[model samples]
Target: MKTLLVDDHEIVRRGLKQLLLEAFPQAVFGEASRVPQARELIMQQEWQLVLLDINLPGGSGLDLLVEVRLLRPQAAVLMLSSYPEEEFAVRAFKLGAAGYLTKSSVADEMLAAVNKVLTGGKYVSVALAEKLAIALGNPQQQALHETLSSRELEVLRLVATGKTIKEIAAGFSLSEKTIATYRMRIAVKLGLSTNVELARYALQHHLVD
Candidate 1:
């Protein structure tokens, strides 16, 4: 099977490779450290499975997930992230990711998720599953952050983390003015004024690290 791993950390990529090798010795792996590199690889090849990290150098893995769905629709993507945040997981699934997994998940869980996704099934952590259940059961109880678009939520997360416009722009490869506009839109939507307010909202909502 051809598997492509998109993560910025070499150690993470290596660890995933090592873990997967125990189960599938014949697996062929390709690795990419940045969004651009991952995009190029996706355009050039067909991967049976893709292990994609959420946090990348210039953008979130969600962006690449969209690209993969378009360029290699047959590829099953299992999203990897350090954050076990339910909001992120929800966005990922909505974007067509086959599975959402935290990096902290046990090897067995990871393997099971991989197996399920590769078999054309979807997987989610138990915690995420419970959260999703509650969310779907109580649609009217949706949190304010849920109203934000994926990009808006991403901007909010970065802003809540105290990232400056320049830094956020650099990470997104967007202009400072564009970042400023996002900030303004976020403030307007949230009805919040200062960074402190945004940070506090994020913390209260468990969006911030």
Candidate 2:
């Protein structure tokens, strides 16, 4: 089996490599710590499984997931994130991820998720399962933030947490102008102006830290 791991943190990549190696002993592994590098690797090889992080340096992992589906339609992509599963998993599944696993999840859970994805099944944690059920049960009661694309939501959270446009741009390796555009979109969607109001809305809605 061939697998690729894409995460910005070297320590995380190292630790995950060790843990996944225990389960996929014969798997050939490729690692990349940035979006450009990851994209290049993906194009250069056919990976059976892709372990992707949600907050990549140059882009959201959801963007990469889209690229993966286009480039390697048959490969299973499992998204990993430090964010709560409820925050991003639904977007991930919609974008064609085979599974979503939080970094705080236990090794056994991680293994189970990987195995399920590798075997042609979707994996969802109990928390995510509950969230999914709630959404299904109340299909019309979608959260306001749910309407935002993953990238837009990410920018909204960052802005809410007092990150300046430049800081948010740096975090995503995007230009300030690009982040400004996202800010406009967020304002237009949320029907709010000013960072203070945005911050207030995010806090009231529990969309940010």
Candidate 3:
């Protein structure tokens, strides 16, 4: 079995390799820490499964998820994140991820999720499932932040976490002007003028750390 671990943290990749090795001793693994590297690997090879992290350096995991689904439709992508919000999980499912797992997941649960994904089944934690239930069961309960596009929402999260426009632009490989435009667009969409308000809104909505 060929599995790709796409996370920015080397330690996380190492730990996951070790954990997954217990169950998939014979598995061949590939690792990528950035979107470009991940995309190159995705285009060059076929993966049986991909454990993708949501907040990649160059782009969002959702972007790579879409590309991976297009390029390697047979591969199962299980998203990993520190954020356990239902919004993120729902977006991943909508973008064709096979599962969403938090970094705080227990080892057994992680293995189970990987097993289920490999077997062509989706894995959703009970916590997330319950949250999804609330969201799905009550469509009116959706937050205004849900209306933001993936890119805009990501920018907002970064801004909320105290990233300057230049820093965010650098990380995204986008022009400073473009990043500013995105920030402006987010303000217009969310109707929040100052960074403080944006930060408060993001925190209240659990969009940031």
Give the whole-model CA lDDT for all candidates, comma-separated.
Answer: 0.89, 0.88, 0.91
Model 3 CA lDDT for position 99: 94
Per-residue lDDT of model 2, residues 1-209, tens digit only: 89899999999989888998898788789999888899999999999999999777666688899999999998999998877777678889999999999888899998999899999999999988998999899988776778898789879888887889999988778899999999999999889999999899878766654
Record all residue pairs in model 1 with backbone atoms less than 3 Å apart, i.e. clashing: none
lDDT of 3 by residue, 1-209 (tens): 89999999999999999999999899999999999999999999999999999888888888899999999999999999888657598888988999999899999999999999999999999988888888888999888888888888889999998999999999888999999999999999889999999999999877887
Mark the 10 consecutive residues where model 2 has the least summed lDDT: 200-209
Each prediction's total of clashing residue pairs, residues at least 3 apart in sequence or on different chains, is 0, 0, 0
- The reply for model 2, stretches above 4 Å from the true place, is 161-181, 200-209
After aligning candidate 1 to the native by TM-score, how far in Å is the CA of 66 from where it should be? Answer: 1.0
Top model by lDDT, which number? 3
Q: Candidate 1: list runs displaced more than 4 Å.
A: none
* Poorly placed runs, candidate 3 (over 4 Å): 175-177
